[model samples]
Target: MQLPLPPSPMALPLSGRFPAPFLPPSMRKAGLLHPIASASLSPTIKDETIDWVEATSNFFEKDTRPIMLFDGVCNLCNGGVRFVRANDRNRRIRLEALQSDAGKKLLRRSGRAPDDISSVVLVEKDRSYIKSEAVLRIMEYLELPFPQLALFLQFVPLFVRNIVYDNIADNRYTLFGRSESCEI
Candidate 1:
């Protein structure tokens, strides 16, 4: 007989409250999370508590370049990734599709649900950034004008920036279309 899958540790509790902020037991045991600064850093699971910053640090090895995780099937996201790859002469940033195994793992390791692909995720320097911040950070690695433009845009308030970002993100599939499969 086929065996049933175990319930996910991330499932909502019986009380109907939101799930706790902690790595799923499977993830915690798999050692997917690595501390950037110390070899001895380990999660304390007392009462299922977790140190989010420590848990999310250095998901990829320190030697690897910054990773930009995008929606694989979204045309706009794919285009954005291609543009970054073409413009990043030094290859300072690495791109991963949210549909990829590595991307899903990184997302989970960063305390986000793997299926929550609404925002682009930028993981760099032992930290994860999302939405407008992630886009702005990615610009820093692109050639000319973009870095300067990103710096200038940073002067805008975060709420206002995110409002624009969220509108684009929410309607990207309708605007730029989507691929039947991941483009790259």
Candidate 2:
């Protein structure tokens, strides 16, 4: 006999669209649409807390591109990367799948537990940010009103913000599906 498939996860209501200020004119004209690919820059984490600062410092010495560390196998993460790439004006971001060696090195340096890879990370200079904070920081650097949203998120309570972010992250695979290979 065949086993039944697991129930699909529930989807949260599509909350209001990102404020008009955040949407690019082209995207606004086209209406809300999911992006296929995007770019993201890593956040700056404090250097003093990380152990492998030397490695990171060496890697970044010659590279000026902003690095983005994300869950390589997550479809939702890949989509976000694509959206950022589309909106980036100066092309400042660089993508790095968290599963890659570079990503692992970055994580080790930051003193974060290995399992913390589940969240998106942004590494810049000697600083880093994770979860909702990372998301807000990234939006701030993007073109247009998206940066405005980051400013608004600052007023939100950390616990409340993280709770919502966690729910979406935990159920992302069920809602958006996943890929066998990393998106790169």
Candidate 3:
């Protein structure tokens, strides 16, 4: 008589491969094993801690600019920066690549992770905004018809607006193409 075959390897010790209930609490809390956590934990910068004096000093010393932070490697982003500069006419807006050291510092000081910032960032003395909010805030600072666009914020829901913004951002390279170099 043939003996019964043992259970397949896949059927044995399922918990060994996939410990649904035995995973460490820290791993579960982090959602994933992030490199930042592995390195060292430090106090995150608070919005109230932004040094306006330092930011303004850097802006003046670097280029006497307003410090617009954008994706340094994105072609569409570079073009958009140029467009904003051209439209400003007054030349009030200054630019910096998010990849730059200064940009990273500012982001950190603002309680944001540089790697996680995918949209344009406009930082002022003590405040910051992201995505569509950043765009609208910039327009408001332009001090003219651009400020009128801020009215759109009232009519559009934040969730709906972010969806459109995120879609464009996700496909910007494919739709608008990319640049070989990061332009200021």
Candidate 4:
């Protein structure tokens, strides 16, 4: 008899890699294992405003600088973090690897799965941004020219910017490679 081939990582759903309990509650509700939704609010949240300060009161009480959560083992992500650290001379931004305890805590507090590392996450005092929005927001802390460029890019349609962001994110590991461990 021939041995059966194991399913590839891509073939497995997000829930397959993690136990049901580890998956987010929303994913568990429908018994579905899909990618995590955008870091923004869900469609059903149209009316009520979330008082994030009260929700995450203890977490952000002391430090209000934006915190960037990035993939620890991704070379491109690590390089991006390094770039921000070097350019943000005023210490305007804070950094954390998604795999860290602090990062996981923030992810949970932000209503994201602890294992969700598909996109960069930026947590400001009152709100959080992800993917392209996070990247552009982070740019505001960089040196002059980049900040100016970021302001200009703000006019671009979110869908258009996210299209570019998604393409790059999808190909990041293949294009920029992965690291054995987080550099910073």
The lDDT, on a scale of 0 to 1, for candidate 1 is 0.71
Cα lDDT tens digits, model 4, 59-168, are 56787787899999999999998899889999999899999988876665555566788889887765667787788889988998888999999899878988999999
Backbone clashes, each candidate: 0, 22, 1, 0
Deviation in angstroms for 120 in model 2? 0.3
Off by over 4 Å in 2: 1-50
Per-candidate TM-score against the hidden true structure: 0.68, 0.69, 0.63, 0.69
lDDT of 3 by residue, 1-184 (tens): 3333433321122111111223245665976633443343343422234553454445456454456788878888988787787678877777878888888766654445646457887766545567877777677767567778787674797677778889999998898887777796
Task: List all candidate RMSDs to the true structure.
Answer: 12.6, 18.8, 15.1, 12.1
Report lDDT per candidate. 0.71, 0.66, 0.63, 0.71
Cα lDDT tens digits for candidate 1, 56-123: 45544465687889999999998898899889999889888988987876665554666779989887
User: What is the TM-score (0 to 1) of candidate 2?
Assistant: 0.69
Residue 102, candidate 1: Cα error in Å is 0.8
Residue 148 displacement (Å), model 3: 0.9
Residue 49 accuracy (lDDT) in model 1: 50
For model 4, the local distance difference test gives 0.71
Return the lDDT, model 3, position 161: 72
Deviation from native of the Cα of residue 164 in model 4, angstroms: 0.8
